[model samples]
Target: MSPVAVILTALPVEYDAVRPYLTAPEEITLSDGTRLERGPLEGTPWTVALAELGEGALTTAILAKQIINELAPEALLFVGVAGGLKDDLQLGDVVVATKVYAVQGGKLTPEGHQERPESWHGSHRLVQAARSALRELRPDVRGHRKPIACGDVVLTDPDSDFAARLKRSYNDAHAIEMEGSGVAHAAHLSRQLDALVIRGISDFADPGKSAADSSGSQELAAGQAAKVAIAVLRKHQPAPEETPGPIYTGDHIDFSGGTFHGPVIGKQSRP
Candidate 1:
């Protein structure tokens, strides 16, 4: 049977933002002890397979591969909050990644570290859907389509040496987050799985993270990201199963609901 999509989240806050769209939810337990919340999306033809996969690219890749093997969702969308890397992206804005850069790849040489970035492009179909959905969404919600850097390190200082290294190789990135590269890699390996990474800006990638959190930027950003995702979902209509074809990937999101008020919702799967 064909399922709608696989929605993966890194943190509980991110997971919570998208949970409300799933109705008639079911809980499934994997052999590895990871639990999944499976259900049909309200007013949509998709059965969303949702999970909070924790953090980091390694774990996310492993778990995403496992989920794809089990559910085989038509698309895999990673929703979460990220630190703003570009000046135009302010706290609470949304960013849909055109590509995810695995910035941690490289080797430390005798003189300095050399960058060897691993990148994965967002599925073209899926991304187009997001762009279409963007047109239908309210104009005031700031959103941008740009590249995002994915690394294991949490950057708190834009003036740090590590930040300098990132700027040298991936200066065009609009935001920074963890686990996007891992999920994109898993989708690449799957060949048929369409993957996208969507993030809400929560901080400036500087030292004032705690202050931002205290000011509820994370929550607001999360909700904004979720809102944009839902818009994509509303506009996206899954293509019918075609004759087995070549590599075609991108994000396509469609949303269905009433007014455009922003709020976050999600489910928790437990043993």
Candidate 2:
């Protein structure tokens, strides 16, 4: 059997679009009050654990920990719509984050704000799968493999101080959203997981947010992002390990655990 993937979203609207893509979907409520829609992808080799965790990285990080601990997914993909930050990225464009920046990290000094940012790059193998998935993207849909900024704030103005600050710090960010960093961090600590953030551009993150949102871009972008996600899954091939797949080895095959330093130090097989 193939491994499972947990797809996370922040809003109901985002969940609505992702839910339909799930096959044999059924709601499962955990003892901790965390709800999940578990199922499989029809043509893909991955089982799906889909959840809508309301909002914020804090909410998302806590829930992510619980879900991964219970489900033990092979990979975790945070899928949803984001406010496009780069000029070339337009509405409905899909961005697969090469790196996720937790943009809110910094310390205010007497002179100026000190840069103390935290960032996580996408899982190497998953990112390779995403790259292959790009070739299969719908012609109408444009996919960008780039960095994205994730924070708790919903940025509405491109000219806002926060926006300008982002440009100065994480200048390579292609889109802005509220969740990915949390999920990434959770996946980080749980060293045995592959993780990535996928977003569709719903708005320009400018003064035109209300206008673009009112025109149904959110739904369109969400759908497109979901499309790219399915594509990524289609391209993904899981390892057939009975235990947590080889992580410490040089192969890095399906590794899902906390930070790996040296090779397997004292771990031994049943002698």
Candidate 3:
């Protein structure tokens, strides 16, 4: 009886990528001064919402909670693009976040990026279901592929030492983005909703990665990522009475290092 909640950055390019399989959202404004335009996908009982971007985890959580108050979706999903952190990952790869990690100061010694020990819960079955759906939807693009990686990292100049620190965090971390961490935080704050963040690799964090082929690559990856995320949400039909646990609480929410201004439209990073 309740609706499904999905948060996507309010950009037309990103929206166009996922629009093929999803229905348009009905316009609604929340009490917290956030506006949402939402709709459901065709053939599936999935609902979507387009929320404003540029907020960090705290702001994202606040707005997400407001949306939840109104929509009461059984599951929450955040769909958008990310910057690939590894050389092996080219533009257009999709990443389904299994866990969310935060950065406190800058980069972590030895471990690369220091995760603030704060994490938002994600479902493995949901990520797997999305991956399986990708296999079914785009068999050609993903024939026998390796696992895609997802997580949050601070974005910095490609040539700067900051990026190098992020690179050292994980060998397989494919992408970086602004809102994934906040989105995760928001879903975790819901206290009664299942949440997932599915990101498409749009650009390599390295400056050398060409932008010539990235647009098309990102578009294709965005479609695949949206389709996969939608499938994951649809596959798990929770009982109407099911309620989420304490994972939604903000007890673990942390944003200590503060903010930085990177490339706004071209690259992804926290706000």
Candidate 4:
């Protein structure tokens, strides 16, 4: 069997972008009625299982765990579009998360909010593979390896309370999204699987976000993110399966009634 990988998206547009890269996909319905598509990724030694689990951190965490348990993929990737937080990140640019922060984990107090930040780092091997893949991509498809902030709400106003909180706490995050941290946490609990979050900048997390979405930036960003994901798969080499050795029940061989034609070497015992 080919090595398996899971690519999860949070929206239909993101799933549509990735679906085209799968060859001869077959629908798989889980016992819980969750649907997924399984097929070989074009020009790679990977069999990809794809799912779109909708939005929100909690929902993503639940469905991601379900998929991981069902497929047992070598790696899991959450690929989709995100709102750019940095000035350098332009629309359609890709961001491969080196670390994902659950930005909403904090406590409100009289002295103000106290941050209890939680984060998960991306797999080092996967990050290296993405770096290599980015070099071969189109010049217009800019890529960055940076930290991402994940929360429950969709950020539209840069001056919103959540946005201000993000700036004060997760200042290093380059992109804001709704699901990466959930999937990252699920993979972390699995212990044996490597996972990464890749997103494309659809809009700046500002009042202009609606205009950007109206101009189809979301679809373009989704496609760009999916392209980077496929490229990473092409550059990555899965670990080879181990071959089982023959089982030996005893330390010594017993040839009790064998007729030997040649000189047989054995320990002679006195009858």
TM-score, structure 4 vs. true? 0.90
Assess each prediction's global lDDT (C-alpha) against the native: 0.86, 0.88, 0.60, 0.91
- Sort by lDDT, top down from the best: 4, 2, 1, 3
Superior by TM-score: candidate 1 or candidate 3: 1
- Identify the leading candidate in terms of TM-score: 4
Tell me how many clashing residue pairs each candidate has. 23, 7, 6, 0
lDDT of each residue in 71-133, candidate 4, tens digit only: 889989999999999998899999999999998777899998898999999999899999999
Q: Give candidate 4's total backbone clashes.
A: 0
User: Model 4: how far is 83 from its true place, Å?
Assistant: 0.5
Q: Which stretches of candidate 4 lie over 4 Å from their true place?
A: 246-271
lDDT of 3 at 205: 56
- Candidate 3: the clashing residue pairs are 25-38, 25-39, 26-38, 178-269, 188-248, 189-248
lDDT of 2 by residue, 41-158 (tens): 8987888989999889999999999999988888899999999888888899999999999988789999877778999999998899998888777586799999999999889877
Reference-based TM-score of each model: 0.86, 0.87, 0.70, 0.90
Give per-residue lDDT, candidate 2, residue 18: 83
Q: 40-65, model 1: which lDDT tens digit per residue?
A: 87777778888999999999999999
The candidate that wins on lDDT is: 4
| Global Cα RMSD, each model | 14.3, 8.8, 15.4, 7.5
